[model samples]
Target: MNKKDSIKACGRTINYEIVYSKKRNKASIVISPDLKVEFRAPHGISSETIRKMVSEKAEWIQKKLEWFEVNRLPDHKKQYCEGEIYLYLGREYPLKIIAFDDVKEPIVSVKDSELNFVVPKKDSEDTLPLLIKKAVWNFYSKRAEEEVEKVLKVYSKKLGIAPPTFKVKHQKRRWGSCSADNVLRINFQLVMAPPEQLEYVVVHELCHVIEKNHSARFWKLVKQMMPDYEEYRKSLKKEGWKYML
Candidate 1:
């Protein structure tokens, strides 16, 4: 079953809906079209706590019915365009779309620190968007892999831990994940985020090799490596999600 169907409420496996507002940065629980329960503070709150908090405020749920109505743009469907700015390694670069006939595959080029998208003529404009996106993603994915290798070399040497096998994936809900088998999965879309964000994601997952959960000890290790991680986390919410199409 889906998450919505799996969650239970008030001793009943009732359908629970989550309502969020970017302006408020808060989440509210609503029961179908009937009721809404607002959580005043949801930052860093886990799902179970959210559910329990909602249950405690079940009485005001009906009163906040209007908040249940919300509309949001579909994730990462925004089209890439020339002059549109993107972040790479904490720096902003303007997108320059170049139409050329000599190149067979879409290529992303950086010269004097300016980024450009070079595409062949055979690819139709209708398909150009996807091509450009793919080209960019591939470029960044390779870069992320390379960066991971370099960072792992440095950290492993310092920590006296060897680099372990890791997989690269494009996760919609998370930047990275680690399995019980010690296999690390890094998100490919992370290449679109700033440099510090990308580094945090990699290190965060690597730390998971030692501590599987986000307990205080895990964060302590992360902070030892990256003291500015909280800023990076907040930065991801601001613009990092745009990486995936």
Candidate 2:
């Protein structure tokens, strides 16, 4: 069963949904990518207990909500038109489109601080947006593949562990994750971020290969790798929206 509810967090009313699950042995709370909050509890838990748990977690929940509010992407879709700014390596580059009748395939390149897209003249106006998006994604994916490999090699030597295999993927909510099998998956969107931030994520997931949970030992290892990782994490949260497209 599920029902909607509201709670007070830092004197603000935050709404969430409550789901009663027979299979759940303990209560859990989750904040979705769209910033929707949900509380899942075992069937026999009391409403009062649930409210207490939410209240106890109020500060953490408020921080997450604030982060989402600051970093959430714009509601409207991107048109990928001229003069639109795109992120690459933490810098902004304007997009420039060129049409050529002799061109057989669309080509995307970066020169003079601009992301240049050259395409067939006939399809430039009608299909440019889609083509530009695909081109941009391909560029990011390739960059992520190359950069992650380099960062992993550097950190693997320092950590004294075998380098884990990694792949670039499109992910909505997470920047990167490491599986129990030691495979690391990085969100291709990260290629748009600063190189230091990307390295921080790589180091973070590499530590997870040693410690599966975020225990004190895990963070200790992370601090050893990058003492300023906290700053990079906060920067990632604040500047993440620019790379969302």
lDDT of each: 0.67, 0.86
Candidate achieving the largest lDDT: 2
TM-score of each: 0.68, 0.76
Candidate 1 per-residue lDDT over residues 1-245, each given as its tens digit: 11332334434443454433332345555342223222433346566776776666644553344344453334445477777666666676788888888988788976556679988878787887788778877777787787777766765565567887876776754688778877778887676677787777888888887877768998998888778988987887767646654
Q: Per-residue CA lDDT of candidate 2, range 56-90, in tens?
A: 99899898888988887556346788888878888
lDDT of 2 at 143: 82
Backbone steric clashes in candidate 1, count: 0
Error of 1 at 167 (Å): 2.3
Please give the distance, in angstroms, between residue 134's alpha carbon in candidate 2 and its true position after superposition: 1.2
Residue pairs whose backbone atoms clash in candidate 1: none
Q: On a 0 to 100 scale, what is the lDDT of residue 217 in model 2?
A: 100
